[model samples]
Target: MSNDQLAAVFNAGIREFDRLTPQVWGPAGQSLITQLRLRPGDAVLDVCSGAGASALPAAAAVGPTGLVHAVDVADDLLEMGRLVASDRALHNVDFVRADATEWEPPSTVPAAGYDALACSYGIFFLPDTDQSVNRLVRLLRPGGRIGVTVWRRGALTDFARAYADVLARHLTGPAPSRTDASPLSRFDTAAALTDWLTGFGAHSVEVTELSNLLPATPQLAWDLILGGAMRAPLLGLDDDTVESIRRDFLSLLTERDVETLDATTLVGTAVVTG
Candidate 1:
């Protein structure tokens, strides 16, 4: 999909994404910042910072003297982040509506480079993962730290498999093929992520798994499918087909007696060595 289309998909489901962030990625971000140990005057960069889930916390950690530049492609998400920052009286954070992969700091930010960069659940979205990591590294000064989080293996896999099965049986048009590999799947394991980060010129690479058992109900499961990445595939389908998929998907979940959503993320941190 084109960038605009992808942005639209995120925008359409911004509410759901925001609701789930606190339960999943928010804690992961907290863990990341805790590891980075931001100081009072540290300058931080948050790439693909959706609704300031991580950026706001980073701003709080950096305090008034520090600054955080938050970048994302979705205007709505950026605006939401700005609102949240304002609500918290966090003037240190500046939300910019731009592509995280190619965006550079404007004059308002520090010139040398950011002291730390945090990208929670976003690095995998870029078309060129290595290039994007390189870009992020370039924005960091020597000894600067970069932290990233990606969904771990088996993260919502059962739910996705169930949904795909339902979708395949219900889709009116030819159903899309299920690929064994997912873009984000590459970073599901710590070893793979460490290797990727090392290849991207990150030294002292450390990868840790953060898992959360999120309480889930049938309704919440349905809402998740409608409000997250899976939403994109369901778009443009007839209402009947959509409802049927949902019904079947929920039925499968019920049959399996799945009560909790396994939200797992691989949090990777690395430093730039001169």
Candidate 2:
């Protein structure tokens, strides 16, 4: 899907997207922050930061002396981030509506560039993953750190497979997969991710494994499907069709004895020594 389609899908599923934060996005964001080991007075640029999940924590980590710029393509999501920042009284973070693939630091950013950069579960969406990331890395100063969170290989296999089976029955086109051949497979493994980073001249690459699993409650099962890019396929489908797909997907989960939703992730980090 194009960038606009991705943004539109997220905007359409605003509530579900944010609702998944506590269980899915939030933990990964916190882990990214911790793995980055942000310091007080450090400046951070969090790309694809929906509702300030990682950006909020990054602002607090940097404290009063530093700043955080959270950028995303969805205006509604950015509004959500701004609201959260306001309620939390985080004066240092600004959630901007922009494309991370083409992000550029404004004058307010330090001349030396950001002290750290982060993105949680949002990199594969870019048109050219490695090239886009290389551009973002240029926004960081020498020795600065960059961190991103991605799905570990085979993560969410059962959940996604069930969804695909149902989707395939409802639609004629190909469905998204949770296993091999997916776009995410490019760097799903630690070795692949490390090599990708090193290919761009990043050093000291470290990949942390975050094992995530939750009970397959009815509510969560549907929300995971509605809350992300997965919903892109269901966009133009009629209400009854979408509902049928949902119900069938859930039933398949039960029939398969799928008790857990695995969201295991990889938090990869590297130092940019220019």
Best by TM-score: 2
Q: What is each predicted model's overall lDDT from 0 to 1? A: 0.80, 0.90
- The residue pairs that clash in candidate 2, if any, are none
- lDDT for model 1: 0.80
Off by over 4 Å in 1: 172-178
TM-score for each predicted model, relative to the true structure:
0.92, 0.97
Stretches of candidate 2 off by over 4 Å are 178-181
Model 1 sits at a Cα RMSD from the real structure of 2.0
Model 2 whole-model lDDT (C-alpha atoms): 0.90
lDDT of 2 at 173: 75
**Per-residue alpha-carbon lDDT of candidate 1 for residues 159-265, written as tens digits (9 for 90 to 100):** 77787777778765644432554567667788988887787667899888887777768766876776566787787778888788878888888787777888877
Error of 1 at 36 (Å): 2.3
lDDT of 2 by residue, 1-274 (tens): 7778988899988899888999999999999999999999999999999888899999999998999999998888999999988998999999998889888898878899999999998888777788898899999999999999999987888888889999899899787655454558888899988887787678999999999998999988889989888898999889999999998999999999999999999999999996
